[model samples]
Target: MRKPCWFLAPPVSRAARWRGRCCTGGWRVRALVRDPFSAGAAALAARGAELVVGTFEDRAAMRSAMAGVDGVFSVQPSSPGGTVTDEQEVRYGITIADLAVECG
Candidate 1:
């Protein structure tokens, strides 16, 4: 059987759409969400996604979320949104990429 694909963002974002597509395509999905109880996360769960509560800043959570997954869809908030600076966004992307490799 194919391993799960990990999504590194909340289901409310673009990840939600991709998650649905993945589900329909017969791929198991695992999402890293900040709040598992949120409506978006709940919707994802209803659609068969395994939700892991974490943010990009949480290395341990990211590692845990990536465990045993076949691949990852890395997504991070960019600058001007104020959630993260441009440098931080780049760093988060790189970090997720590195972790995906390490997990493999």
Candidate 2:
């Protein structure tokens, strides 16, 4: 099977709030965000999507968490990954691209 399409990478705080129990699925239906830990999986549990979350930036941890996952959704940190490379401008573009592909 092909790699699973990663959908969203909403912050842990946001995903924890609107997980499951939707209100006509307005913003809730925009796309799923996969955060570290069980946040993403918990959020998607009620939506019929098997999303898995964990501290995958840790290689071993990421591998373990993504063992069965088909794809990943991620964004580099604004400072280290973004500021270091001074590519903060590309952050939004990357996010949009990821969203588009995941939504498709």
Candidate 3:
């Protein structure tokens, strides 16, 4: 059987969880990132994850990235110096959920 596709959004925490998923050799991980050239993104790519270039703020991008995903793992940064506002975070989370429903 073919592996299910999992879309991971905003892979913070050094993407440890994402790396674990990649190493498990079951699901096909599709990680979203603003910069595909970034070190973290490169690491994920090295671990067999397919990189999708975009931010959570872009609904179109998110939807596009989630086109064939069977599951989604989204995380929002909560650093005191983070730029995203609380309302934006909520909106992005909702957007991801909505997209998952729409895609599924």
Candidate 4:
């Protein structure tokens, strides 16, 4: 087998050049967005790919939003006006991951 394409942003792309989902020979691709507009989601859906849109900001809300998803892509959401401390960001990331695993 060649490899799995995991488009996990710029940093993670070196390992896997993530591309849109292709069902031709067992290729699966997905994108994590805060929301999936109908036009884009419909286009991706037409190609037999999935676009996960978590319609929430809070952890519990996001967990609920992604309740049935197989895997989760999370970012600790940065704000220009109010940036979180590194420690806080780490904790937030962990919380999201744990919650996602729990819900899934």
Candidate 5:
């Protein structure tokens, strides 16, 4: 069976590389993003990622995205600005990890 991979808030650079790998049948890639219509998300989809519309804080979305996932690559925002504080970022990361464990 093909290994399924999930990418959380994947940046363009890493997404691009992963997309290439997925195209070559390396593994199945599911990209989780807040906005699926965004240009970056569109690009990832165009390259072969199965887009999972979601945010770090959305538990339902995270759970749905992580179902049957073999591995996960979380890429959260670096600067905790705009409504998100450092503590919130940590919480979001923990939430993702927790959901991964729960789903697995």
Candidate 6:
């Protein structure tokens, strides 16, 4: 039987941990990354993750990333640094959850 495919979103370190565990368990790991060429993404690729280049705000990309995956592991960015607003974080979380249900 084929093992399941998992779609993962970052903070890279956490996703990398999950990726490691999943890869070790013989499951396919797919990662959603804003920049595929970034060092973190490259590290993930080297560790056997399939990188899906996109941001959480991009619904089309999110859908594409989620396609055919058996599970999704996502972490919405917190707004402590003002990089992402509270509302935006909520929206992103809702969008990802909605897309996961829709994709499934």
lDDT (0 to 1) per candidate: 0.83, 0.42, 0.73, 0.47, 0.76, 0.77
Which candidate gets the maximum TM-score versus the true structure?
A: 1
* Off by more than 4 A, model 4: 1-57, 77-82
**Could you arrange the candidates by TM-score from highest to lowest?**
1, 6, 3, 5, 4, 2
Error of 4 at 99 (Å): 0.5
Cα lDDT of model 3 by residue, 9-74, tens digit: 455576577666654667777778789998888888887777778877777888887887667777
- lDDT for model 2, on a 0 to 1 scale? 0.42
Alpha-carbon shift of residue 63 in model 4 (angstroms):
1.4
**In candidate 5, what are the lDDT values of residues 20-44, reduced to their tens digit?**
6664676778888778889988877
lDDT per residue for candidate 1 within 36-95, as digits (tens), equals 898888888988888888888899999998999989987687658676789998999999
Pitting candidate 1 against candidate 5, the one with the higher lDDT is 1
TM-score of each candidate? 0.89, 0.32, 0.82, 0.43, 0.81, 0.86
The lDDT, on a scale of 0 to 1, for candidate 6 is 0.77
Q: For this target, which candidate reaches the highest lDDT against the unseen true structure?
A: 1
RMSD from true fold, candidate 4: 6.3
| Model 4 agreement with the true structure over 1-104: per-residue lDDT tens digits | 22222222212333222233332346554544444665545555565555556432355455554555555544454444576566666776777667766875
In the predicted model 6, the residue pairs found to clash are none
Displacement of the residue 51 alpha carbon in candidate 5, Å: 0.8
Off by over 4 Å in 3: 1-4, 9-11
Which is better, 3 or 6, measured by TM-score? 6
